[model samples]
Target: MFLPDVHAEPDTEVLFQFIKENPLGLLITGINSTSVDFLQCTHAPFVLDLPNAGDNTTPRLRAHVAKQNPQVKAMIETLDTKPSETITLDQEVLVLFNGRHDHYVTPKFYTETKPDTGKVVPTWNYSAVQIYGKLSLYYDSKTPETGAFLGKQMHDLSEQCERSVMGFTGDGDRPQPWKVSDAPERYVELLQRNVVGIEIEIRKVEGKFKMSQEMRPGDREGVVKGVSRALTQVGVTCMGIHLYVPRQ
Candidate 1:
């Protein structure tokens, strides 16, 4: 999360939007004295639990994941050995959500288009966000509560997915659409057995939007147009594609 001033995004709205758009996150933690224990999780859009009046310093995050996932096992193992290391109900963790990115930026796109004198090399532009917070893991004693939480999380995720992808027409609006109760008992039991609820308290957030912000206006415009055309040729849309436009 080394965010240079040129690419730093301090706006909270922008950071939240990035997280909402990219719900899938990479949860990294040090395990077994190594820094490589990472879990790629499709996290449900979680709420930041903030203190009301007196307690404003500590913030927490809330989400859930499958209990059967290996990351949970790793966490449990870590907790068992080092109880002190276990993330408390309000301990912050780092959550990283990455957006679409690709290589293959050609210098010709900017250099040839712009009236530049010096030579220019290829570069790539992308966006990403790092959220630091504590997490809370929740478990239900009764099947009803478990079903309710799981159902709500799943429904929210499905709605997000549908809204993001175009041409989705599956139960967009319903007061009581597809509840866990609609499914068979066995399915609900299976979900209850496998799912693990998660909550994270975010203390700080860092966002990097490296979308040709360092380039001159003309150079940036050229790059945007070039990248857009190139991506379209390959049937893709890249970051900052909408930012480039020809002036009258």
Candidate 2:
């Protein structure tokens, strides 16, 4: 997470939006930092809950995994914790969101404008957000809160994804969004029972948008054009500010 001040997004609001836009985050965890022998990486949809004004609660991200997942088993074993009850891992983990915005820029895009006459090399333009935090698992509920957290997490995550799939701005061709309640209650409950809920107590969040802002104006435009052609996005919000480079 090497965040340059020039590309950092300090505004929590923008970062939150970015997370929402990219829910399929990569969860990376390991048994110990000393070796990569037991490293586990998973990509899953996560729901972020931001603290409200005056609220003392810190931000948290929630997701779920099948009970059979090796990563889940390894985490439980590493912490010597039972999966039947709520448990938190002492080791911190990382979650990364790429937001489906990335592109390759060739030298041809910058040769004309760069100061070094046609000396520019190929590079990548992309945006990424990283979350560092301790992870907690909610399995069979030992308490009311723990038991209900799984259901709520599933419901909220499903609703958000449904909205995204159905189009927030409203698409005439799309049907009504789906919900957890749409399925038979017994079936939904049965499926939920076979999975485990997870929550991350976010200790820090970092955003990096490398959209060629460091390039000269003309070279920058060349980069943006390539990005625009690839991603259809001319503007991207840096972690705190906005980078008006289009990654077509």
lDDT of 1 by residue, 1-248 (tens): 77788788888767877776677777654444232255434444554444667975665555667765666665665553432232353234678788766445566666544445656767777779888766655455144655565566656555555555433554456243344456787876676657666756677888988776666666776767777788788887565354522222
What is residue 62's positional error in candidate 2, in angstroms? Answer: 0.6
Please, what is the TM-score per model? 0.72, 0.84
Quality of model 1 by C-alpha lDDT: 0.61
Report the C-alpha lDDT of model 2 over 49-166, residue by residue, as the tens digit. Answer: 9898899999999999887777877776766555576788888999999857566788777835654776677887778899999998887744576669978988898789878745
Where in model 2 is the C-alpha error above 4 Å?
Answer: 32-37, 111-116, 141-143, 168-174, 229-248
Cα lDDT for residue 58, model 1?
Answer: 65
Top TM-score model: 2
